[model samples]
Target: MKIQQITKEVSIKRSVDSGTEEQRKTVQQIIRTVREQGDQALFDYTKQFDQVELTSLKVTQEEIDQAYENMKQEHIDIIKEAAANIRKFHEKQLRETWLYADQHGSVLGQKMTPLDSVGVYVPGGTAAYPSSVLMNVMPAKVAGVKRIAMVSPPGKTTSLPDGVLVAANEAGVKEIWKVGGSQAVAALAYGTETIRPVDKIVGPGNIYVALAKREVFGDIDIDMIAGPSEITILADETAIPRELAADLLSQAEHDMRASSVLVTTSQNIAEQTAIEVERQLADLPRYEIAKQSIENYGAIYVADNLFQALDVVNQLAPEHLEVMTKNPFEIVKHIRHAGAIFLGRYSSEPVGDYFAGPNHVLPTNGTARFSSPLSVDDFMKKSSIIAYSEEALQRNYEKIAAFARLEGLEAHARAVEARFK
Candidate 1:
């Protein structure tokens, strides 16, 4: 890895794809087809893309039971533990309806209601992430969502991964479907005869799935147009070179487009960490993917001091940030943006990715600046309540009518006048 001296904080940010015109056009067609043809379009696209003929779109209870029987007991135990952690963390975020009566006897309150249903899209193929099933579904379950519908690509050999099915079952997802890619997203957004339309869709997927989410955004809620996974490490001479290198490669192996960056004040550690990354890269099974990622998007920035490195970290607003300095908490207090922060060397990114209760479905590709991780809050909606007494209405009627008149709305003024009359 090459080292660059930090000159401008803005220069540290990575580039993100908004989507190609061709991708947008194709996704639109998929959305339109699913909207028009429903279940037939889903079947055709599954055969066309996945090359798998499906008798049914929905996963049967028999399959779920078989998944539980086939998966290792230890793996099942771990999924249950992870689900518990996730549920515990999100449980704190739950809110209740509350009302307040003003001095004028006007009442104001907010009613929080969970979304009726949600569609969770888990990617399928070679990679199986039972973790994603837990991360996306558990939060919705904690928020009290009634129907948690899940969709994933049908495996060439099997309809869905046993681990994924087991995890979904553990997370309380009732409906699981063997559909994926843009077509699956389309089916979720618009209803196929078999698949009911959901209030929102939450999960990760390939570019086609992401683009499909972008196209159907207003029609249905989407988690985010997730870009490549990313991780940034702010370390010093005290930080472990091998551990830092290992952490960088962990995210790098996610995809060729994934980014792994290191910002440090120590020159010696920067060079050693770079060498360690190379050493560790050779041992990784996904060496080619990690190597390409490091060569293209990876970087080592030698900053003037810890403060300068902190400035660079905030500028990037990375999806995952690891502070491996001597006083991690002291440094963490200065961080303004990051989807998730791991303090000290022991708190690796994967802890949060798998075991930690906080969501692994984080804002990626610098969207952490404005967005947040998927939480129970994402699965709930709030409606404001206002009830004014006659006394309260009479007192404010003139001001309300005047304000409406200032906006050139005669109907609004008349309504208020009629109330007073």
Candidate 2:
């Protein structure tokens, strides 16, 4: 980890991977083939990429039961409890269709409707993240989406991970598929023989999956193109160095591109945290990955004061921000941009990642400046409601026509005039 003195506003903006020409071309071809061949394309791709032969695309009840058998009862209970917590949190974001009327007999409002269907992509291979399943699906379910489909590439045994399956079941997802990569995204965008098209696709995956989402974006909605995990800790003299290092490495271990940064007022704390991070890296199972991440992207900045440190945080707009100052609440008001804010020493970033009610699917890179975490609103669409009584129309029709004519939209002017006549 490198330590530097903060002198001016700094940006930790990383270049987002947009895929190579070859990869983009390949994704386009994959999408085209799935649209043309449907289920056969998915099966062929599964065999080629995943090395698993599948007779069917969908997960069966027997498989779900077997998944339950494979998982420990305690693990299942934990997933259920996590699901309950997630659902309870998202249910608060649920909205009702509303309309308002005035004395003029004009009604205007917004009608909120959940998407008809959604597809959630859960990554497979070296690790399985059941937490992601809960984070992605619970919001759609809370918004009253009728169908939620889950897709993950199969392993050699031709089975999805037990934890992933259990989480999906607990989150109320009925449809699960044993396919992944660009092809699964294609299948979700354009209906296959067995899998129907969904209105939107959510969740995280590899570069190929991100490319596929980008390819099919306009045709079918997708969540943001997520970047590597990042955590920026803002601490003071009162903060513990070891705890700060541990929290930073939690994200560093995620990927080689993950970034861990500390901006603090105390130089002593900065030097100690850098040493603590190096010390902790030795024990991490993903040592090489974390070590590389810290070497390339990690940094500790010595700020003149708390105000100067916060300016850097706002400029970076990190995916995860941890405030470990003496008074985190006071510091929180100064933070304008962060995907998720974990305040004080006890609220570690991992708490929000798993057990905490907040959705872990948050904007990465500097996108936190403009976007937000995945919520129930992402799974729902709003329709503008407009109603005008005859009296109201008579009063405003000429003015409406004149305004339309001012824009040289004669047809629009005639429409309002015709309504009045």
Candidate 3:
């Protein structure tokens, strides 16, 4: 509710980018216990934590099939429509392994190949995000990954969310497990008796799930270790007050810690936007969460000018950035970092999340400074290929031999030297 001027320096340490240390310690313990006791440990943890009593750790094919029967045709149709959007967007990223031959008939190039398998982690609760299921699986399917597995916690009141199972089925996930939390990550990373270890893991999750992913980096691949959602709006006098308010509240609905900030050159616009936010907040379903987030993490800055506002944006590197200014594209040319940039007044972040082509699994907590959103490239690998004819080997043998000798290993030189001998 308070407005402040943006000086050359930020005063609030620009907010620290870190996970809670206590959460990390708790998650590490979960990972170790699950790794040691396997399914038994997982069941105990699930009952102790999620308050669910499960007979099996894996979601059966019957469960997935029944999920379809319970859903309305219209809801299924929407999932299909969303899947088509996700597939269409990711298809542009598909690639084939390539080879090139020189005039000498020597072949050399990098081979692009899909990873052998990947695991997707979906959070579980009364409300489920079928969108996340599609986002995590469609890209791997697009990349031609052979096996895609899913691990989501089971619900206590009802079965796993129908949309979740339906989306996973539509996206070609090979296996689905009724497990979640750090234990799910450990199972996916280390392989339980029933679940096989996967080449990579991708999805949105809580603090424990994130820390578990962080600990599993070497044993398996993971998507970015994300933090709370954040959105930054860089505007001038031209920014639409009503639209900017909607965008700020969009991210605030994600969590109490999620951040939404409006930085502009015009104080008048800032005040108007704040008023618009208050008006719109009354209607949103998650108003309490959004309000708490805004009260604690939200901010308004009246910069000296558009250039100064843009400078603050670079320092924040928010997960979702909106350019709500005259000539949004013109102003974006100078911007360097953001998980996703919505260039115009009409392009809100939620459109990209539910229906638009790009992935919503973006870096958060200022990680966009160095990381990128999830994509097909995250589910593929490249193997370098090299081949040489005898004549070519003979030409380079002396240099190769010298390089080995310089490293103080004569056996390495002899391996090549013997060929020339």
lDDT of each: 0.91, 0.93, 0.86
- Can you give the lDDT of residue 262 in candidate 3? 87
Report the candidate with higher TM-score, 1 versus 2: 2
- Return the TM-score for candidate 2, rounded to 2 decimals: 0.98
Better of 1 and 3 by TM-score: 1
Ranking by TM-score: 2, 1, 3
What does candidate 2's lDDT look like per residue over 116-204, in tens digits? 99999999998999999999999999999999999999988898999999999989889999999999999999998899999999999
What is residue 323's positional error in candidate 3, in angstroms? 1.5
Which run of 10 residues does model 3 get worst, by summed lDDT?
A: 9-18
- Summarize candidate 3's per-residue lDDT along 70-145 as a digit string, tens digits: 9998999988988999999999988778888876667888899999999999988656989999988999999989
lDDT tens digits by residue: candidate 1, 1-421: 8888888854544547777999889889988999999988988899999999988888989999998899889999999999999999999999999999999899999999999999999999889999999999999999999998899999886479999999998888888898899998888888888888998999999888988998889988988888889999999999989999999999999998899999999999999999999999998999999999999999999999998899999988999999999999998779999999999989999999999899998888788899999999999999999999888999999999999999999899899889768
User: What would the TM-score be for candidate 1 when compared with the true structure?
Assistant: 0.97
Q: What is the lDDT of residue 270 in candidate 1?
A: 94
- In candidate 1, how many Å is residue 266 off? 0.8
Give the C-alpha lDDT of model 3. 0.86
Model 1 segments more than 4 A misplaced = 13-15
lDDT of 3 at 421: 90
Overlapping backbone residue pairs in candidate 3 total 0
